[model samples]
Target chain A: MSLTADDVNKIAYLARLGIDTQDTESYAKDLSGMLDLVAQMSNINTDDVAPMAHPLDQVQRLRTDAVSETNNREAFQKIAPQVEAGLYLVPKVIE
Target chain B: MHTKTIAQLAKGLRAGDYSSQELTASYLARIKQHTELNSFITVTEEQALTVAKQADMALATGNAPLLTGIPIAHKDIFCTQGVKTSCGSKMLDNFIAPYNATVVEKLDTAGTVSLGKLNMDEFAMGSSNETSFYGAVHNPWASNTVPGGSSGGSAAAVAARLIPGATGTDTGGSIRQPAALCGITGLKPTYGRVSRFGMIAYASSLDQGGPMTQTAEDAALMLQAMAGFDAQDSTSVEREVPDYSAGLNNSLQGLKIGLPKEFFDDGLNNDMASCIETAINEYKKMGAEIIEVSMPNLKLAIPAYYVIAPAECSANLSRMDGVRFGHRCTDPVDLNDLYIRSRGEGFGTEVKRRILVGTYALSEGYYDAYYIKAQKIRRLISDDFKRALQEVDVIMGPVSPSPAFGIGEKTSDPIEMYLADIYTIAINLAGLPAMSIPAGFIDNKPIGLQIIGNYFAEDKLLNVAHQYQQVTDWHQQTPQGFA
Candidate 1:
């Protein structure tokens, strides 16, 4: 259950985080140690066990489909780092 | 006086001893004086004063609720209308929610004055408040030590007497662990007891908002206003919320308390064990019965919680892409960069680590082996609580294995930090109600005794905690330097 440096790199890439190459070795070691602890779960017999999602067995209730809120575009966009014409502007995606 | 409890304050307000404006002003002054603790993310002084004035008018008309005009703080996790709901992450740092969370609305309806939003672990991911984008909260008891988190700010604020009471969300040990470390009362009610609508989701299944206060009765009083069925939150229970404050004085006679043998085994520190034993002995003298019970699956709680919590978090946090809302990258050549840079820049280190682990666990090839397997194990943990509860009315144990550790004690070692939550994570996994009450002090530091109950057993848990407070003065004791 050892996590290789490659595995750590792949995970970091997927998460979009830049980890220093020097730290990768230590992170791999630490992650492998954590995986070893997590690996213990494989020993338990769960053949008949049902996967529990919610704490209660009840069904989710539905609210009316009617609109409870009005458009507050100005108020909503006030927190954006950058915005114009009721549109959120991000980095240019096309050439 | 600043030290008065919520009940006392409410009584005083009723008696015209102090107006809501004065109380609100006192709390605002305290917040200003205690800026070194970094307990608050934002303080709503103008809004608080306006609310206080309205409360004073209501009181003059003799029509105020029990919690009317009492100053309180909300965990940043709960969304407040027109207030920034950052969840301590950079992604939503500038995001002000348009709607109020159910808990906040309920408290506002009760006429409670809002002091501000408290700090927390980013997306409620870490145990220590250091993960917060705002800054870490210092434990009021020991300035150098961390106030245990992700509810660190709420606990520190309440314990420091900056606010009489505050709200906190517990996904893992967020509320109870911090409350224990900060020497206050924090309760995590049954999963469906409190509505989660508008509460920024970390792990939806485990997230619940409750009260962090100076006494069990105060927790109960706040819970009374916070808990109920909400049509907005599909997961909210339809069952009536019992009057939690009504049974605070109930006799503890014939109450069966189960002491899980596993909780007291190795890894249980002597000081914490002694404090718990003393508290249990006091309960015994007050006519309560204690029986030893076994829950073998207790050892698996941490592992199971790690899997389930992250798996859910991976899905929940995916919505933070640099598209509809939240942080965005400055320049992107393509959509992929937009997504990647936005997330990389927005999330903190611990949050990114969790998102990676969760994404890996739920990935195409690993779903069955990790995510699905953890779900099955989650059921076993819940069943363990059910079986143990059938034999006893409540389960008692140490909230954390030890008192507040130094600020950097386990910051570098994730495993060591994870183990700190060993005693508290199981309750969240089982979706049961639990509370951390100030048991006693060890080496001049505070220790907490955990009381766990069956689903919707908040009333009983509070009763036990309240009765314990009646016999002991531990909750009344404050840290020396701060006082």
Candidate 2:
């Protein structure tokens, strides 16, 4: 259950987070410890038990498809890192 | 004026003992004097005075709301329009919320003047306040001790009388643990009891917002305004919010109190256990019948919680990329670079640890072994609480294992910090309402008596804590310098 350096790199990449090279070893250690703790759950028999998603087990409520929110594009985009003409500018994703 | 509880302040405001403007000024001054405690992140002095004046005009009309002219603060986790809602993360350091959270809106409508946002663990992640991008909040009781968080500032401010009351969110003992450590009253209402519309999401299923105050009576007043249904939050309950203060003075005669055997086990500090036992004895003197109940799965809560909360947090926090409203990195060559560096730079060490753990748990080939298994264990833990509550009106236990530890004491070890919440985490998993009240002091550090109730049973929990506060003066003892 020990997360090696390779495992840390894979997980961090999967999470889209960049871990410092020096910190990767420590991350590996911490993640390994957490895995050990969560692994304790395997000791119990949950074969027939259902996975509880919500505390009250209530289903997500549906609402009408009609618009319920006011447009606040300008207000929201005012704090964006890069925005031009009401569009958020991001790094080029495609050539 | 700052020493008075919310109830007393309300009475004084109505009786003209002092103007709301005067009261707000007094509290603002107190907050300035105790700045060393690091309880506040953003103090809204100008806005508070303006709101205080409006409250005075409303009071002059003779039909002002119950909370009108009262000064309180919100845990930075809540969205306060025009005020910085940092959520204790550099990611949101520069982001100003465009609107108020439903809880903030409700309390504002009740005419409560907000002092400003208080500090918290970054995105409500850690047990102690150390994970905050803003420096850790100090417990007023002992200057060097850590204030239990992620509602450390709310608890510390209320305990020091810097503010009459403040709002706090509890995912895994965020509100109750800090309240226990700071010697104040904190209530974590039933999941969805308070709307989470504008509150930042940490663990969606388990996160709940409630009141942190000096006394249960004040907590009841705050909860009355805070509790309700909001169409904005799909999980917000549709049930009626009862009169929270009506049953505060209810007799505890015939009360079936459950003392879970697991809570008094080897992990609990002996001295702290005696203080809790003494509080329970007082409950017995008032005609409460104590019944020993066993909740064996209680021991498994921490592990299950670490799995589920982080898994949800990892997903929820995925929205904090560079393009959106929060912090963004300098130059990035591509989208992946943007996402990775922004998150890496924005999140703290503890937050990164959680996100990584959650990502691994929910990742390919490991989802069933970690996430699904943890959820099943969550069900077993909830079942344990359901069975125990069936035999008792409410359950009693120590809120935290021991009193507040020194700053940096448990920060190096995440597991040790997580274990400090053993007593309070299970209630969140079951979605039951619970409260933490100052029971007594251990070596001048405070310990809280946890009162847990059935789902949506906030009134009962408040009554239980209120009755105890009536006989004991522990809740009244303020820290020396602050007083």
Candidate 3:
């Protein structure tokens, strides 16, 4: 499956990336190259094999249901792009 | 001081031959002298001296361990509290980590003085350091040549003797490829061997932290402290980490080494293949047995890894959206603009390319065709390793297809660069332990011999590498001008 400029632009949008129009053409080419490379998987018959998601093949370990973490809002917010009153502030969403 | 290995330095400190302060200071001077290599992204001088003095106190008290007072650098992927953990990207240029990664905290307990965070490919993507936002790391052997990545800076720093050792992460061939190109020893342990609590996520299943050092013995010391179970990291293994340093002198008699038929098939460089044969002959003389093994599914490692890694990265990096931490756009129209522009300006071309690929693979319509199929093929690739390891003690092959290439050699074409990791990526796909040790050279550029072992077989891999070093001096051959 080859990716066109529109397909790449949609991918960039889904990825929340602002890909410039000029780079989209190049991206389409590169993405198609990658797609062509991965298309070989279709030839291999993995019909009975289970998809291995994790290496260890174990579920995530459960922990106690309690407040284990300390309050580090001040420390955490220090690196925030914009923080006000210990809250991360972003551009207005609600109209 | 600059020429000594980690073991020699530790012995010197124990015998009162030199203080940790003197060693740290000497290394700091060398790091400054070799600034042209662009190995270091940040050098924590004041903190290094402070830690060095503390190590000296421990030495004076006669309570120092093997790594006490030794100066080392960390790949920026491991977050260091109070330091700018850039991961070699502009996205985190101003982001100071709020806490230390498990690896960093373990090193602190070992009393290793940190030089600073080293450079890496942006978010540990890319086959060469060319993708690093800071700049490409220059090969110590040749300035115009590239050091392999994403552990390029770590390999270059250790290779140049700026520091005795460093920490590196391998999601694919990151650690071993760079180590091979720079003529050092780098070990990528079993997937869950080292805790990933604080290390930045790349491909979560494949990413692992390990040691980059001058010798296998030194790598053992570093890996000893770095491996363990962590409650914070849900995926960390719950097993005992044996004394890796204790088994370095083990005998190699009757050790069955599998020579993968797939590794030598077309695409390997001629001189590099010769060097691999020489190294294999060395092992034969050491009383080891060599057998040919065919891994028919190994050819699919590249495609499987490219798909699986990016898919995970797309999800992992989604958290970097502008609101919480890291780079943010200026005067965004709204939330969508903030994310789009911040990511656009923040990520490099290679990183963006991967994110786009990953997003498409994991998207609604193509999920089964790309993402799930890759995962199924991942199982086939791993099963081949299981079968091969059953016949031999370890698998032997070239770490990279060739010696270090020129800086801009393959950067223009992504496929060409991706093939550079052909031999090394299969190990990470299987989540097994593997290492790269300097074997020989091609036209003065270093080549590496890759040793791969079954799950949690780090000791056996290090033992074989250590025995090889005992017979050869390739790891000791430094870059001419730097020496």
What lDDT does candidate 3 reach at residue B310? 91
Residues B119-229, model 3: lDDT tens digits: 999999987899999999999999999999999999999999999999999999999999999999999999999999999999998999999999999999999989999
Q: What's the residue-level lDDT of B378 in candidate 3?
A: 89
Q: Candidate 1 at residue B369, lDDT? A: 81
How much of the true A–B contact set does each candidate keep? Answer: 0.48, 0.84, 0.81
Model 1, position B232, has a per-residue lDDT of 80
lDDT of 1 by residue, B259-309 (tens): 999999978978788889999999999898989999898898888888788
For each candidate, give the TM-score of chain B: 0.99, 0.99, 0.99
Q: Model 1, A1-95: lDDT tens per residue?
A: 78888998888677665466777787787767666767778899999999888888777777778998689888767766668888987666576
> Which tens-of-lDDT digit does each residue in B401-457 have in candidate 2?
889999999988888888788899989988899999999999999889999999989
User: How does each model score on TM-score?
Assistant: 0.96, 0.99, 0.99
Worst 10 residues of 1 chain A by lDDT: A12-21
Model 2 misses residue B234 by how many Å?
A: 1.2
Off by over 4 Å in 2: none
